[model samples]
Every structure is written in structure tokens, then in C-alpha cells.
Target chain A: MSPRSDTPSSPSIDESRRGLDLGSDRRFLAALILLGGTYVSLLLAMVAADLFYTTPGHLWHALGSPEIRYAIRLSLLSCTLTTLLSLWVAVPIGYLMARFEFPGRAFLDALLDIPIVLPPLVIGLSLLILFQTAPLRALETVFPVTYAVPSVILAQFMVACAFAVRTLRTTFAQINPRQEQVAMTLGCNRAQAFWRVVLPAARPGILTAATLAWARALGEFGPILVFSGATRMKTEVLPTTVFLELSVGRLEAAVAVSLLMMGSAVVALLLVRTWSGTGLAGVSSLRNG
Target chain B: MISLRHITIQAGSFNLRDLSMEIPTGSHTALMGRTGSGKTTLLEGICGLRSIRSGSIWIGDREVTNLPPGQRGIGLVPQDGALFDHLTVRQHLEFALEVRGWALERRETRSQELAEWLGLTSLMDRLPAGMSGGERQRVALGRALAFHPPVLCLDEPLSALDDQTRGEIVAVLTEIRNRTGITILHITHNRSEAERLADRILHLRDGRLES
Candidate 1:
């Protein structure tokens, strides 16, 4: 008896096998593309719904309200201050984390991550609890950080600075330490080398960090609400404005504020992306050389 | 003179031990060693870039082991030139003078003189990325010499060049040595470089120096 194949070995079968192979190769990719498209489309749809929910005239009128106007100005001013203060802390912390070996260095690094990982409401609660203590409470009597104008800026900075420090640390690490070393070898003191060489080299990272911190501060709601409370024309920021509008059953006003924030975020992201893309390209070329 | 007295440094897994050497003022000394034999570590230790675990360093009657690299008055030309990517050749030369608080006119004249001396006058406005390997090395050398440092440390300065370019750099080094009479502590693995450039040869093996 001759050996026999169990299945038919035909030309059409071979062609069908090739077709199946191609189909299998595309299946995972097709699934991924569909999933990604669905996610992006959902986000775009939500934004579109907000944009179309209110008439342009209603949005303009809502934005023109004195309360809304105050929220906008407060948000812009507090966020700007938060960004500057965050950068001031972030630069030194980032530099030290990147360049130094100190006692408790690992612990300090992990500590910096707490704000980013912790719930925003919890951060607010922590701040409130700290202010309830002896020294901080005593200081609060003079500074009035609790439920005050300064609290708006403070709450935003508390969260935004963690993000800024993370960004700047990565930036400083990407830079070659040899550049600083070479600068010092050329008769520069440590400060001179940092200002003249490392700072300029890290300009891109700095811009990204500042813009991101500002955007975060602009959108901060939980911490601001818990620490500062939403007072009309006082502690109200953009996010608080949305909450206040929603609470009063003014959905159009809430959507209008949300739309403004979304627009601001988009503009900030665009600026950051453009700046970082150019900055990183320059840094990489220099590093490669 | 540049002097190292029984210096020891630990860098990662490699340990450079008991490295004592002396280069008389205005003389060129070449350090030769195998790959991973701690030549660069020794050079860095002398330049105050690396901390010595023990022993001391001196430059021209001053004990400089405790001084910062800037205070030691030692110039270093690292491997691959290590030029600041953002700075032009002229800026690189002016950086040290600026740190030393040189006036604008003095900085300009010094930069011009060094640029002319290094044949970098034409390349003064170009960034390091736009320059060739030899050109970058020349710029590095000019920057190192801009402050008129008492001792210059060269860490395999020509190892990254083509033979022709290396020859050109060697010529430049010879010219610089003859013209400036600066004390040079050069690290190299090539015997021909040692023969051509060094008045004395110090060979490193297993973290020890043999002169």
C-alpha cells in the first residue's frame, strides 16, 4: 500500500492558505487601528457635543458675565503664578536629583512622586490638615492660605510642581554631564557653567515643563475645591466656574467654560509640541556629534 | 611642573592605584596603556575631574588636590573633543575669558589670537556640529589654551581621526608645543604618537605606572 495524504493537496487549497496567512497577519493590526480610532473618535465626539450644546450667542453671553470673566482672569493669573513658582522649585529639585548623590536621595525621589500618584482630593485634604496644625496654622493667621486668594495659587502649584519636576529631571538627565564638566575645565565655576551651558541646553525641556504646569493648574478642580472652596468672584477658577454653573442648573454656562478650557489646553499643547520638537532635535544632533 | 604623588582612584570596576608621575614644566609626557588600562582615569584624576582616594597632586608649587578643576588652572581636551554643541568656535574660546571677567576688548583680542594660532580664524562663527572631526579638535584645543592654563591634559585627542587628519593634528600639536612651551600630559596607545610627541613615556599596566 502506498502512503496517502489525509487532506487534499490542491492548487486552490494552496491559494486559500496564502489568503488565510495574509488575513491572519492583518487581523491584529486591523483590530488595533479600529480600537485606536474608536478611542479618538469618542473623545472628539464628546468635545464636539460640548461645542454644539450651546449656541454661539449663549456662549458669548455666558463668557461675558462678570462671574465668568472673574473666573477667567483668576484662572489665568493664578495659573501663571503657579507655573513660575513650580518652575522655580522644579529646576533646583530636578538638577539635584539628576546630578547629585546624597543621603536619602532615593527616598526624596520617591517622595516627589507622591503628589502625582496621590488622588487630587487627597492632596487637598493633606494641605487642609497641614494648615490645621500649629506652625502652619499660626502662619495661616498672617498669610491666610486657607480659603483665600493665595490658596487658589497654592493648590494649583502643589500639583503642577510635581509634573514640572518630573519633566525637568528627565530633561537634565538626557543632557551629557560631560558638557558641564568641560565647561568647568575651561575655568567656569559651578554656577557659571550651569547658567551659561546647561540652562541654554535645557531650554526646550523648560518650556515644555512650564506650559504643562500652567495647563495642569488651569484645569485643577478637586484640590482647588477642597482647599480653596468655590466662592463667586473670589476663589473661583475655570474648573470651579464649571462646577458652580452645573450646581445652579446652568448647563450651558458649564459647557461654555469647559469649551474655553479645552481651547486653552489645545493651544498650550500645540505650543509645547512645537517648542519641544525643535528643542529635542537640536539636543539630539549635538549629543550625536 | 605637574606632579602626582601615589594617587589612587576607583571608577566603577576599574581601580587606578599608586600612580605617581612628574612632568617638568614645558615638557611633553605621554601616557601609554592597553585598552581599559585606566589611562583616561589617571588623566581625569590629575585634571581634578576624578577624586583621588588618597595621595596628592601639585601644579607649579601649589597643592591642587583639594582645589576644584577651575582653581587648579588645568585645561583638558577630552576624547571626541567634547565641544559645547550650542556654542560657536569664538564663543567656546571666549567662555573661559568671560568667566575670568575679561573685558570685551581683551576677550575679543584673546579669542582672535587663539583662533589665528589654531588656524580656526575662518571657522570661528561655525557651531561644533558643522565642523569636521579635525576642525572640532582644533577648536577644543584653542578653547583649552584660551585661559593660558599652566598644564594641559589631552585624553586621546587624536584617536577619533583618519590618518591624514591625525597627521594634521599631530603637526598642530608639535607646533603648539614649540610655540607655547606649555606642559602637556597626553594619553595615547600608539607608540608612534608617543615617539613623535612625548619627551618621556609613562606606561600604565594593572593600575600602576611604569616610567
Candidate 2:
């Protein structure tokens, strides 16, 4: 007799085949998780080392130094102001881009990201040329100073607003306007539905936009240096302070400022990660669909 | 009562032409149509989400054809439930109540009552994302009925659920209708769903209401 073939439809065989396939793909998944974890660990290590090496006494002494204090105060004030102003403008622009179908929308959206890709020095130089000129200089003179504090704000504002608008627009785009329409059918007018339905939905995106804009404004240096000279106590923000100390061979001072900025950034990152429920909600909504 | 006459709307390539139907007061009416049979477009036209070229929509004693969606007291539960993903189930109910300017205590009580009625008491603290499809539909239904509009419209509410969940939701919806006596216009492609839930059935084909 010919050799008999025993081909049983065993469930165990099917499961083992699936198990092998899964085992084969596990390496790629492990590599991705490991890479991400390593990147985060490196960031944490850098931050901890900088902050720890600078003793409290050193930081306390630096805090008393009028130049450092001025830089800290100015950075905080300007970044806060820039974040508020950018949000006021970005929210509406972002909402319009997300909700409406209009001419040049794609081009408008692309234009918003230009600042992110464009060099900060170039942005600073462009503003310097634009506002430091005859007609624009005349406009600038209405304020006490142009090439110092205000210029820093203006440059920071320009870049921060660009990021804010782009991030918010993406967030709003993720939300469906159908929710608002449904709210309307349930006896809500436009304003009512917007506040009760749409705004709440878009809050996470708005918050993310705020955080990113604040971070960008805080780290701003090249633009501030080019447009607003790095005059200590006048236009010197944190990053510029770091650069000035480094150039003067005051490595300890530079490290201290770096640590401060790092702490601020870490706090911002934690806040974003912890309270980004809206972002999480939007992501889940997309996944559900 | 709500009535539509000769409603025509074109969105991109999809066209609904000469559609007409009537939803009587205090009756649950079902609109059965295949996908792209203009079921949603027709519903949107009535709610003013879509502008119609030629049509008359009357709600109660008023002609609301040209009124904005908010001005028409028509409650709509979309396929997605359209619940604000950021809001808690309780907040979703209160959002409508607050918009209608209901007193705070009343709004709170009403939300509580609705949460209990829909068996959503345990899930009241959760967002739409945390809920199952059936749970979300119940929440959306509760939100729509919170303020008690003159008429309610449900667009394929059960189409997204599994068979077991679909049966459970249909029973819940039926209970709601029986309790409130609110007129409902439910649009669905599933004939079995229509048979199980509707008091009357109207079919749509090529944008026209068929006998």
C-alpha cells in the first residue's frame, strides 16, 4: 500500500502556526519600544545631570545676580504674553481652517508651517529689516524701544503664533462638525453649540497649542539675538543668557541657566503628558471610526 | 407633526430629488432605504443641515423650511452618537439642559433621572470614549430627549452595533418611546430593525418616497 497521509485539522496545529508568526514579529515591536524608551531616558538623564551639578548655593547666587534675574523675569513675562496673544489669534484661524471649505485653504495651511522650517535667524533678520526701516521704524518709535525687548517679543510672537495655529488647526480638523450639527438639532443655536459642544471637544488641542507655543517662545534665541541684540538685563531671555555666559567662559553660569530652562521645559512636558485628556479623547475617537 | 414636500438637495454627485414624506405627531415613523438612497440627506434637509432647492418642511403649525437647524425643535441622534468626546455622560445631558437655560437643580435632577432610566448610572462619570457602542447610543438618546424637543430623529442608530447589542438598544428605545409618547422619525437601511421598532414604514428609492 502507498504511504498513507495523515492530515488532521488540529486546532493545536493552527494555534502553533499563529504563535510562530507572532513570535517572528515580536522583535520589531520590541525594537520600537526600546528606542522610544531610550530617547526618553537620555532626556531625563541630561536634565537631571544639569540640574544636580548646579548646587542650590550656586543657583541661589545666580538668582541674586541682577542679570540672571532680569533674564528670568523677562523670559517669563514675554512667553506668557506671547502664549495668550497667539492663542487669541490662533484659535479662530485654526477653527476656520478646520471647519470651512474655502479657497486657498491648503496653501494657507502650508504657509503657516513655513516659520517652523525656516531658520529662526532668517525670521529675526526679516523682522529687523521690515520694522527697523523708515516707515516701519516710524511706527516702532511710538514705543520706548524697538531693537531690544519689544523686538524680542515680536520675533517670538511670530514664530510661536505659527506653531500655535498649525497645531490647533490639526486638532480642530480631527473633530467632526457633525457633533455641532447634532447639538443644533437638539435645540442649541450656533453660539450655544459652539460653547457647549465644539469648544469642549477642542479644548485639548487648544491646550496643546498653548504648551507648544510657550515652549517655542521660551527656547527662542536666534531670532531674539538677530532682531533684539543680547543686551544683558534688557532683551536677555534664558537661552540668550546661556549663550552669553558660554561665550564669556562662565561655564557654571551657563549650566545654571540651562538647568533652569530644562526645569521649565520638564514641567511643561509633564503638564502636557498628564492632562492631555482631550488629545487622548480625539485619538480614541479616530480609532473608533 | 413634521412634513416634507418635494425636497431636492445635491451634495457633490449625490442627489436627492423630489422627496416627500410626512411624520405624524405622537407616532414612530421609520424611513427604510438602502445606502445612498438619500436617507441621511433627506433627514439633513429637514433639520436645515442641508439647504434644499425646492421643499417645504412644516413642524407643528409652523413652516420651518428656511429656519436654521437650531430654530427647529427637532432632536437628531446621528450614527456616531455625536457625543462630545470630552464630556462625561452626565455633562452631555446637562449641556443641552444648560443651553435651554433650565434651572441648575432641575438640570441636575433631570440628568440623574436620565442616567437611571438609560441604565447609565454606573457610566455617568465616563466619557464617550470609555463607553461601548450601545452605551454611547443610549447616552446620545438621553441627551436628545433631555430637553424633550417636539420631534426626534434617529439616523441608523442600531446599524453599528452587534446583534446582541442591537436587540438590547432596540428594547431601550422602544421603552423610551412608550414612556414619552414623543414622535420619532427613524431612518435605517435594515428592514428587520424597521419591522421590530417602527409603527409605520416608508421606503425611499432614487430620492423619492415610495408607497
Candidate 3:
């Protein structure tokens, strides 16, 4: 065969092969992109449809109603209390699980997940049963927690604490234990090192845990409904408000409550993202040192 | 004086077996070892960060093998400084003094003294993230010296610095040794560094010390 003829055919063949490869790669990538985008669009469409279901005037009226107002106030106070309590429990438990070796560490770690994996209704029912026990019942005489304002906070904290613990555990695990070791060598006891060094360094994780716990508490309904009874203006939070409105055939009010919760969750998540993003850079750079 | 008597420590897969040595008070002793030779393990064992399988660590007149790291009174400058990310250099130096229950006025004076000695007076306001490697090491050194422990342990302190920075740190170490006359157990891989900073050299191979 002539060299020129062979060269021309080979170049054309290689070009065609390259085109085929690029075409197939583009098709595969496009299909995956479309599939992922469609899944996200499905969620967006559901939220958007629910948001616009009622007229703007109707939503405003529902939001301004006395019942909705009570729910909003109750939701904010209970969620904030729940977040604070969750962090109190999360920090110690997270540090214990991350830094110490104990006989029951794995068991305790797994037990922490029960709240996350269990049905919300079960958690509520469990709390209800727990208060009925002789000791808790005696303590209830002094501090009435069940079916009261305190019940709302307790229920939210039960689930929120689990999530917070998980977040903070991962945070502590990511930190170098050498920092604590060095601190100890520099004359700090274990508690001092944890407070001055580890806790401050884990600020991003703490913020993330608090945000997640707050969001979870804000949306918590099943536990509140079962344990706290969701009485009007008493134990009613935002999620329970939706249920209460739907029971009373107030469709617009229920949709408006759902929209309010969605808005709050979005805003809270955005704030957390901004805070953690800036805070993490400082932490990572310090860790690098 | 610092002494390890029949020290046997097991850390992960590495075991420091029956290793014993003594550094006289005010002597700078270098422990030279290759990577994975358990130099850090040995250092941490002496610092009480790692529990020994069987041994006793003595700092000055006290047997610190059973004591916690904080009560052992041995200061450690870990590899890469390991400075607190959230604390400024001044705070880093003041931490040990505060923990030791020094009065606020005394802590301030000691911090100022350490800053001047380490050439960190101007950088005291900056956090470790903004400092160069050499600066971080200097801060670590100052922090380790803040409590005035009779013995100090340095783990690969100069390994992360450039040649110029390393020289500066070695000079600082020499000055510190001269002024305070504190016992130093420095771990390094470089022979020249050991020779420069240490009055006595001990080689570690396969986790066993060979003087």
C-alpha cells in the first residue's frame, strides 16, 4: 500500500474514533446531569406549589392570626431552649466518645443513635411512659414536665440532642488530639485543655450542631402531638399548628404554617452556612499550624 | 535531671523496649532516630501522654510515671508546634502560667519576658495561623518554657523549618539552654542538628536506644 494512502485513512479513522468517544462521554454526562437535576426540581416544585397554594392575602391573614402567632412564639422559644440543652449534652458526650476509651463507649455511642433512627412517635410515647414511672412521677410533683410547657422543650431536646451529639463527635474526631496533648504538657489539665483549646477550635462544628438541632426542633411535631397534646396556645409549635389547622378544616392556615417553617429553616441554614464557612477557614489554618 | 528506668512502651505497632537513659540537669540531650523508630512514642511516654508497659520516668527528684501529664511538670513542644489555633502568641505563653495559678501581674510579666526572649514581642497579638513555621516553633518553645518546668521535651521541633529558619531556632535553643539551664530532651533525625544543639547524643534504632 502507498504510504500517503495509509496515512490519510489512519488519520480519518483516528478522528472518527475520537468523535465517537466524545459523543458517548457527552451523552453519559448529560443523562446523569438531567437525572440529578430532575430529582432536585421535583423537590423544588413541591415546595413552590405548597408555598403558592393560598393567595398572598390569605397567607398573610393566617400568619397574622392569634393561633398562628402563639405557635410561632412557642416554636421559637422551645427550639432555642432545645438547642441550648442539646449543646450542653452534646459537647461532653461528644468529647467523651471522641477522646476517651471506656468500657461502654461503643454501647453508648450506638444508644445515642436510637433517637435519630427511632420513630418520632415512639420517642414521644417513651417519654410519656418514662414520666409515669414511680421516681419520675415523684419528681413530676416538683417539676411538672409531662403535658406542659416543659414537655415541649423536653421532646424537642430528646431528638435534637442525638443529632447534635453526632455532629460534635465527628467534629472532635477531626481535630488533632496532639493539640490537647501539647496543652497538657503546657500545664493545662484535661478539662482546661478541652475548654480553652478543643472547644474554641470546634466552633464551626458547634454552630453546625446547634443549627441542625434547632431546625429539627422547629419541625418536630409527632413527639409534641403525642406527648404534649398540642393544645391551642399551650403546647402548640409550628408543626403542631399545621396539624391543628388541618383538623379544623383551615387549609390556608395549615399551608401558611408549612410555608413559615420552610422559610425559617431556609434562613437558618443559610446563616449557618455563612457562619461555618468563615469560621472553618480560621480553624483549619490554625489546625495547619 | 531526667531519667527513664527500664521504660517499655507500646504504641500501636511500635514498641520501645527496655529503653533507659538519663540526662543530667542543665544538659541538652538529643535522641536521634529514623522515621517510624518510635522517637515520638518514647518522648510522649516520658511526658506521660503515653502510658508505659513497664517503666518509671523521673524528672528532677519526682517519679512521674504514674502521674498525669499536667502534674508531671514536663513541658513538650510537639512536632509542627501544635499551637492552639484560637489563641494569640501572648495567650499561648500565658496559658501555662495561668494554669499554674500565677497571679495576673506575674503572668503578664512572664509573658512579656518570654516574648522578648523569643523575639516575638511584635507578633504576640497574632494567632498561630498567621505565623510562619519558625515563628510558630518559637511560640511553642516559649509556651513550653512559661511554667519553668525543670525538664522540657521537644519532638522534631525543627524538622518543618527551612535551613535558615532551622539555624535561627537552633540558636534560640542554645540561648534558652544557656540562660535557663533547663534539661532538654530533643528528638531529631538530622545528625548535624543533634550535634549542634545537644551536649550528649543518643541514637535510637528499631525503638531501642544505643548511646
Candidate 4:
């Protein structure tokens, strides 16, 4: 080909390529949208189905029911308690696991994962058996645990805490270790450095761990069912309320309860997201004071 | 005076074996070494961040070999200026005093003095994340110097800076050295930094000092 005839200006070449690029880009976008949209659509569809099946009246009626009201109160109480307890146990374990290297560290790490990997029902069964041991049996006489309110919190904590610990371990690991070292050199002892430097820096992670623990505790069913049992106005929680309603062929009640739990979850998530976004509202006072 | 007598530091598989050196009081020294030459391990041993396997570390006349880092009366400015992200410049300067149980009024005065000295008075309320590299480095220096420790250890402190910023920091460091008369052990790869700031320079090759 002749150079003048065959060769084109760079702008002309870019213009031609732009035409093809637009079509390809549109197709690529469509494929990605379809793939991601499919999963989101499924979720939307299920939620829509729940909305379609239950009315405002059904939610009100479920709320009016004495059993569900008890379930709501109990669920709120136990989930908060479970979250508090989980954070207490998880933070120390997470810090130690992330910051130190010792003999049997690997073994201890594997042991923590057993709750996450084990079947929930097995955890419930294990707890039931644990309570039967001589020491726990002796303590049981002082306070009833199995098939009681305490059992509800215990069951939720067993699984929820493992999740909290895992999240916190990752959270603490991501923070700079140099900060703590610097703190120690600044005349703060090891514990003081952790309290002031390490913990304050790990605010986001603590929020995440607490949220995960709360959410996991809210949805827990298998362990609660196995150990606490579904009783009316006593050991009954929201999950059990759903199970009891469904077993008795009250689909509307179950659906209403489900929506209630979903709303609570959304509210909890939003609260945390807002709190975290706001820099935890006076970090300087907390850290320096 | 600071002294390390027959010190040994074991860092995993690498070891700085039986090294010994002396840093006279009120003198700033620069230590230079090739990569992976155990400069950091040796620095950590002196600051009590890492425990020495054998031998003694003495600050003045007291044997401080067994003391914790907090009790050793030393200050550290690691590379990258590890300032706490959640604290403001004022908080950073006041941290050591706060932890040491200084009264609130005393801490405020000390932080104000440091802010004036380091030219950080304009950044008192600003968090570390909002600061420039040079600014953060200055804050780190203020934090190290806040409690007025007798010894200061700098680990590759000026390696992460542009030339102009480096020059400014070098000037600030020189001012600090002259004014405070505190002993400093600065680790760096830049010969000019050593020439410009240090009273004496030492080199580390294969874990032993070459004066």
C-alpha cells in the first residue's frame, strides 16, 4: 500500500477505535451488571416475597402476641449480653494471638476455630454435656443454666465470640506494632501502651467485631434450639419464636418475625456505620485522657 | 555515658554476635551499615526494645541490662515517624508526660514548650493523618524528646524525605542536638546527614563496629 493512502492520522485511528471500544464497553458492562444483578435480584425477590405475604396488620398482630413480645425482649437482652461478653473474651485473645509468637501458638489458633467450623447443633450438644460434668453440675444447683435464660446467652456467646475473636485478630494484626513500641519507650508500661495506643487505634476493628458478634447472636438458632429449647414466655427467643410459629403452621407470624429481625439487623448495621464514619465522636479525649 | 559490654542480640536466624561499643554522654553519633547488617537489632538492644542475650547495658553508672523499655529512660524515633493516628500534635507531644503521671498543668506547659521549639505550634489540634511527612517527622521528634530522656535512638529517621525536606529536618535535628545536649545514636545511609549532624561517625560491617 502507498504510505499516503494506507496510513492515517493518529486522531483518525483513535476515532475509529473509539467506535469499537464503546460497543465493547457496553457489552462488558451488561455482562457484569447481569452477573452481579442476578444475585442481588434473588435477595430482592425473597424480601419482596416476604413483604407480599405479610401485611402491616400481620406485623402488628405478631407484636400483639404475648409469646413474641417475650421473645423480642429476651432476644434484645441476650444479644446485648452476648455481644458484651464476646467482646470481653475476644479482645484479649485477639491481641495476644496477633501480637505474640510463642510455643503452641499454632495449636491455640486451631482450637479457636473449632466453634466456627463445628456444627451449631454439636456446640449445643457439647454444652449440654459440659454442664453434666461434676464441676458444672455443682454450679448448676446454684443457678439453673441448661434450658434457661442463661443457656440462651451462653449458646449465642459460644458461636458469636469465635467470630468476634477472628475479626479482632485480623483488626489488631492490621494496626502498626511500631506504635506500641513507641509508646513503651515514651514511659508507658506495656499494659498502659496497649490500653492507650493499641486499643484506641483498633476502634474500627472493635466495632466490626462487636457488630459481627451481635448479628451472629441474633440469627443463632441451632445451638439455642438444642440447648435452651423453645419454651413459651421463658427461654423463647426470636429465632425460637420463628421456629415455633413455623412448626405450628403459622407462616404469617414467622414471616412477620423474620421481617422484624431483618429490620433490627439493618438498624444495627446503620448505627455502627454511622458511628464509625464519625470517628467515634471524640477520639482525642479518649486517647489522651 | 552509655556503654554496651560484650552485647549479643539474636534476631531469628541472624545474629549480631558479641558486639561492643561506647557512646560518650552529650555527643551525637551516626551509625552507618549496609542492608541487613543488623543495625536495627543493635539499636533495639541499646534501647531495651530487644533483650540482649548476654552482657550488660549501662546508662551512666547504673546497669540497665534487665530494665524494661519503659523504665530505661530512653526515647526512640523509628523510621516512618510512627505517630499515633488518633492523636493530635499536642496529644503526641504530651503523651510521655501523661503516662509518667505529670500533672495536667505541667504537661500542658511541656507540650507548649515543645510545640514552640519544634515549630509545631500551628498544628496543635491537627491529627497526624492530616500532616505532611516533614511535619509528622517533627511530631515524632517532639514525642521522643517530650519526656526529656537522656538518650535518643533514631532508626533511619531521615531516609524517607525529599532533599529540601531532608535539609529542613537536618537543621531541626542540629538545633535539637545543640540545645538539648542529649545523647543521640542516629542510623542512616546518607553520609552527608552524618557529616552535617554527628560529632563522630561509626560503621557496622558483619555485626561489628568499625570506627
Best by lDDT: 1
User: What does the lDDT come to for candidate 3?
Assistant: 0.86
Model 3, A165-188: lDDT tens per residue? 998986786677888888888777
Q: Point out where model 3 deviates above 4 Å.
A: A1-32, A132-134, A137-144, B12-14
**Lowest-sum lDDT 10-residue window in model 2 chain A:** A1-10
Error (Å) of candidate 3 at residue A25 is 7.5
Rank candidates, TM-score, best first: 4, 1, 3, 2
Best by DockQ: 3
Q: Of the candidates numbered 1 and 2, which has the greater DockQ value?
A: 2
Where model 2 places Cα greater than 4 Å from the true spot, the runs are: A1-60, A133-135, A282-289, B85-91, B105-129
Per-residue error (Å), model 3, residue A149 = 2.6
**Reference contacts preserved by each model:** 0.53, 0.67, 0.82, 0.67
Worst 10 residues of 4 chain A by lDDT: A1-10
lDDT of 2 by residue, A196-235 (tens): 7778777888888899889989999988999899888888
- Please list all clashing residue pairs in model 4, or write none if there are none: none
> By descending DockQ, how would the candidates be arranged?
3, 2, 1, 4
Candidate 1: docking tier: acceptable
Q: What is candidate 1's CA lDDT for residue A71?
A: 96
Q: Arrange candidates, best lDDT first.
A: 1, 4, 3, 2
CAPRI quality of model 2: medium
lDDT of 4 at B142: 97
lDDT of 4 by residue, B1-211 (tens): 7899998888878898888889999999999999889888888888877778999999999889999888788899988787888889999999999989999999999999999999999999998765677898899999999999999999988887888888889999889889999999999878888888899899999989999
- Which pairs clash in model 2? none
Distance (Å) between predicted and true CA of B22, model 4? Answer: 1.1
